[model samples]
Target: MRLDKFLKISRLIKRRTLVKEVAEQGRIEINGSVAKASSKVSAGDELTIRFGQKILTVKIQDLKEHVKKEDASSLYTVIKEENIQQPTRHE
Candidate 1:
């Protein structure tokens, strides 16, 4: 499945366009390498996504074309999620 579609269907990003934009900006990666919106993904692939100040890493467990909101999370396993601390401004 394409990265954008997978993210959308999995309810990770909530939208396809945003996924594409994020991927283009190099905020998405697959297996430690930068990934594109059209990048091919399969089961067992690890995806690291940076969303603003939070970073989320998930491993693809299944690739489904369509899934209900309640079951969307079944597609991937959350490995970790962390918030990026911003540096404080100093005078």
Candidate 2:
């Protein structure tokens, strides 16, 4: 499955266009390399997504064209999630 579609089906990003924009900006990485919207994804692939101040890492467990809201999270397993601390500004 395409990265963008997978993101949507998995309910990770909430939208396809947003995934495309995020991938284009290099905020997503697959297996330690930058990923594009069209990047192919499959089981066992590791995905690291940066969303604003939070970073999420997940391992793809399954890929489906469609899934129910209750089962969306079964697509991937979240390995880690951390907030990027912003440096305090000194006036």
Candidate 3:
């Protein structure tokens, strides 16, 4: 499945457009390589996503076109979450 679609279906990202934007900005990676919104995602693939001050790493556990809110968390397993400091501005 498409990376963007999977992210939404898995409830990782709340919106499809945001996924696209994140992927385009090179903040998403798959299997240690930078991936695009159209990148194909499958079971066992490692996904590292940057969300604001948090960096999340998850391994894809399953792929589904539709899932309930209660079951969405089952699609992927969180490997780690790290807090990152934002870059300071320089004039």
Candidate 4:
């Protein structure tokens, strides 16, 4: 499946357009490299998404064209999630 579609179908990004924008802007990475919206993804691939100050890392477990809200979490496994610490400014 396409990276953008996978993100939306998995309920990670909430919208397909947002997923595309994020992929285009280089906020999403797959298997340690920056990936585009059209990148092909499959089972066992690692995905990292940088959203604001939080970074979410998940491993793709399964891919589906559509998934219900209650079953969304089954699509991937959260490997790690960390909040990026901002450096304090000194005036």
Candidate 5:
């Protein structure tokens, strides 16, 4: 599935548009490489997300086109989450 779709359906970002914006800003990465909104994602892929003051890492456990609200969390596993004074971005 698409990175944006997975993020929204997994309840990670809540909206596809937001995912696109975030990805465009270099706030999203896949398997250690920068990812675009239309990037393709598969099970077992690792995602590194940079938020305002925090960074989140999650492993893609499964990809589902449609999932119940309660099962959204099943899509990915949270590997790490950290708060920082400044998020390092090459750009």
Candidate 6:
């Protein structure tokens, strides 16, 4: 599945357009490399997302065209999530 669609179908980013934008801006990575919105994804691929100051890492468990809200978590496994401190202005 396409990276952007996977993100939405999996309920990770909440919207396909947002996911595409994120991918285009290089905020999303696959297998440790910057991924494009059209990148193909499959099972067992690692995905890292940068959401503001927080980072989320997950491994793709499965890929489906559609999934229910209650079953969204089954699509991937959260490997790690961290809120790393970033340099602030006026130090």
Highest-lDDT candidate: 2
Better of 4 and 5 by lDDT: 5
- The residue pairs in collision within model 1 are none
TM-scores for all candidates: the values are 0.97, 0.97, 0.92, 0.96, 0.92, 0.93
**Candidate 4 lDDT, 1-91, residue by residue in tens:** 9998899888999998898888888999999999998999999999999999999999999998878999999999999999999999999
For each candidate in the order shown, give its overall lDDT on alpha carbons.
0.96, 0.97, 0.96, 0.94, 0.96, 0.94
Model 1, residue 52: C-alpha shift (Å): 0.4
lDDT of 1 by residue, 1-91 (tens): 8999999999999988999889999999999999999999999999999999999999999999889999999999999999999999999
TM-score of 4: 0.96
Which residue runs does candidate 1 get wrong by more than 4 Å? none
Looking at model 3, report the run of 10 residues with the lowest lDDT sum: 9-18
Clashing pairs in 4: none
Which pairs clash inside model 6? none
> What shift in Å separates residue 56 of candidate 2 from its native position after superposition?
0.3
Which candidate do you rate higher for TM-score, 4 or 6?
A: 4
- In candidate 2 the C-alpha lDDT for residue 89 amounts to 100
- lDDT digits (tens) for residues 1-91 of candidate 5: 9999999999999999999999999999999999999999999999999988889999999999999999999999999999977656997
Q: Candidate 3, clashing residue pairs?
A: none
Error of 4 at 58 (Å): 0.1
Instruction: Give the alpha carbon lDDT tens digit for every residue of 41-90 in model 3.
Output: 99999999999899999999999999999999999999999999878999
Whole-model lDDT, model 5: 0.96
Model 4 lDDT at residue 85 = 98
lDDT score at residue 71, model 2, on the 0-100 scale:
100
Better of 5 and 6 by TM-score: 6
